[model samples]
Target chain A: MIVAERKPIDEILGFLSKHQKIMLLGCGGCVTVCLAGGEKEVGILGSELAMARAKEGRPLEVVQRTIERQCDFEYFEGIRHEVKDVDAILSLACGIGIQTVAEAFPDKVVWPGVNTKFLGVNQNVGVWAERCQACGQCVLDKTGGICPVARCSKSIFNGPCGGSQHGKCEVSADTDCAWALIHDRLTRLGQVDSMREILPVKDWSHSRDGGPRKLVREDLTLESGK
Target chain B: MSNGKDFQPKIVAFCCENSGWLAAEAAARLELGYPEKVELIKLPCSGKIDVLYFMKAMEKVDGVMILACQKENCKFLKGNERAKSRVLQTQRLLKEIGIEEDRVTIQYLAANMGNKFVEIVQNMYDKVRELGPNPGKVIK
Candidate 1:
């Protein structure tokens, strides 16, 4: 899911200074799963803002609404009327949701309430770790389910470097050597021979180096004449 | 605790939708007034209550009560069970922070028990009134 964490209170307060009536929009999709921008979080942010404003003796009017998914237009439609009245919107969705809100409402000022961290899964209760980098490549079949691009601190393509010491990365003694994990995992699955095939240096041109990427599937597109 | 001004304890209650929340709504419908001091927030399941929510509530209110479905009857299978664990975790955190554990309370109730909901709210109000305003808030 799109993992996120709340921004500092001062930063949030700064964004709200100009707006007397503000709405906090929470997404129930990835943000809810990560427990960052859910209904509960909306309430907390609203209450915190209220308290802070009350302290300053400048009580602001704040309302909260949680939609099913902020990424979709249908869910965004639900709050269209409500959004018109508020001076500003504090989006509690991921980066995508924030952008979608901005695009959907060109006139209304939108502020991000949470920092979109990374694509990750909950390691356990309250612990989230990076799992995928979405580097426009899929090599999970060759390696184990883990992606070295995310698990490795350096995003190394091949196996462990010389910096690996006792199965731990030299960068951080606590972090596990991602390549070593892949090597051990491949050996257990009898795919050790695949490792000998020299992996050519990765081409940076196809990735984010060339700027934003777009995929167009001709078969899925509808011709204008049709 | 009587002063010249009427004392209304700041109590925040998190009620599970399957049980406690419905109970509170039912109690309200029946005109069974729970303590006016208690402000209730409903969750899909008490298990879904985040630690951040709990921490924020502790800062703003004098007392908190997490109301979940009765043991062995949670709609989400083990939601009530999970809520119990989180409540315990929050209790320890509050204690560690030097706030009395009694400031946070947890209870299990079936959705139909409107009377029980009122009783719980009244008990929470009384407890919080004794504690008075949150010490952390007072310090600030």
Candidate 2:
């Protein structure tokens, strides 16, 4: 899931300082599962912002909506009338959803209410950790399913870097050294030979180093657009 | 609604059925009284309360009190513990937005602790009155 956290309240307040009314948009995709930008989150933030504004005597009208998935253009169609009612939109979705909503409604003043943390998995109730960097590559099969690109402090390949101490990252005592975890996992699986294989230098172009990435599906693309 | 000497803070109490709710019923049967302005909202368990509900309650009331079972005494094992965590999280959210974190609180008791229930509520009522109206209270 795309995990995110709400931005600081003061920063959010700053964004809407000049506006009297705004829509609090939420996405029911990854954020909802992570307990961040869901319906309940939207309600909580909406009530807080309204009260915060009312305290200043400026008051604020919050039009709250949680679409199924804000990244899709069609999910937004149901709330077109709501968009027309507010001065701006403050989205509590991931970076993609926020940008998608902004691009879909170019005329509206759209702002982000959350900071996209990472592509992560729910480790436990109320806990999420990054699991993928979306490097346009998959290395899980080679690394015992532990992601070095995300879990390692340096994204080091074939590494328990010199900084790894006692199976923990030197950067933080609490963080497990990803390479150590991989080593242990591979050792347990009797696949230590794969770990010793010298990996080729990774191609950076497949990842964000090549700039904004886009996926095109010729099989799915409409003939008219082609 | 008067912000003067006659002011009464509007308070909402979410009482877990196994504890606070039964205690409040006992208090009523005993003819003990609490401020009418402090309303009681009964729920299955304190754990069932969500942070959203806590914030939304602020829209209608000035103060919120969660009445849950005592630590280690919840019928559902860790219900009160979860409620306590949620209350703390809710208060943190409140404080971040410049509202009094004390405006929301939690109390633990049993089905027979009627006096404690009344005592804590009266304390909340008095404290909220001193703190003045909730800045988060929505204007009509």
Candidate 3:
């Protein structure tokens, strides 16, 4: 899931200082699972804002709402009427959701309340680590299911770098070397010979440098006025 | 409605179904009188109480408590442990906002302790009375 953390409260308050009436938009998908932006978080933010406004003696109104998925237009349709009266909006969703709201409400100022982090998983309670870079390729099969692109500090695709010592990365002694993990995993699976294949220079053009990417399912495109 | 006397504190208790709530029910069945000041909210497990739930409850009440099973009897293994951490987090938040940390508490109890349930609630009532109303309340 896309892991994210809430931005500092003071920063959020600073953004809302100019707007007396604001709407807090939350996403009920990835941000929800990560406990950053969800229905519950929206309520908490609204209450905190209310308390802060009361303290400042400059009272402001904050309305809270959560969409099923802020990335999709259908989910955003649920809040069109609710957003009509607000001077600005604070989106608790990921970067994609924030952009969608900004695009939908071009005139209104949209603020992000959460720092969108990497694609990762919960190692345990309150611990989320990056696991994927979405590099437009998957070499997990060749590397014994360990992703060097994300797990490695340097994102090394080849053998362990000189920085690796005793299976740990030198960047952070607590972190295990990605290549070392791959080596152990391959040895366990008897696929050590797979490392002999020389990998081509990765084509970055396909990943992020390709300029705003899009996926179009030709048959799924809706007709106009439908 | 206030009769010009100071507001009475609102107390909310989140009772774990397997233990605290069961004890509460048993106390009621046995005619053991607990303070009416505390309202009981039953949860499947205490660990299910998220940070938002604690925040929301604190907003609505002056005092909040989580009643969980005895440490050894926790069916979910770490549910009691998780509840304690969240309760501590809520306490810290309350204190940071100028609210008294004593307003929120986590109490572990045995399921069959009818008399003990009454004692725990009465203790909460006394503590909240001493603390008075919530600092977040509008003074007007």
User: A154-205, model 1: which lDDT tens digit per residue?
Assistant: 9877768889989999899888888888888888888878888767677766
Tens digits of per-residue lDDT, candidate 3, B68-118, equal: 988877999989899999889877666555678898899999889888888
Tens-digit lDDT track for model 1 on B1-140? 24224667788899999999999888978889876767889899988876567767875677888999988888888988887777776676565435677877789898888999999889888877777655543212
**A1-226: candidate 2 lDDT, tens digit per residue:** 8999999999999999999889999999999998889999999999999988877778899999999998888999999988988999999999999999999889999999999999999999989988999998888989999999999989989698899889999999989999999999999999977878976788878899999899998789997873
Residue lDDT tens for model 3, A190-224? 88888888767778766777776777787878878
Q: What's the ranking of the predictions by DockQ, best on top?
A: 2, 3, 1
The CAPRI classification for model 3 reads as acceptable
After superposition, candidate 3 runs with Cα above 4 Å error: A52-60, A209-226, B1-7, B17-36, B44-48, B75-78, B92-98, B111-115, B138-140
Clashes of each: 0, 0, 0
Highest lDDT: give the candidate number. Answer: 2
iRMS per model, in Å, is 6.8, 0.9, 2.8
Order the candidates by TM-score, highest first. Answer: 2, 3, 1
Q: All models, DockQ values?
A: 0.11, 0.81, 0.29
Look at candidate 2 and give me any clashing residue pairs: none
Pick out the ten consecutive residues of candidate 3 chain B with the lowest summed lDDT.
Answer: B1-10
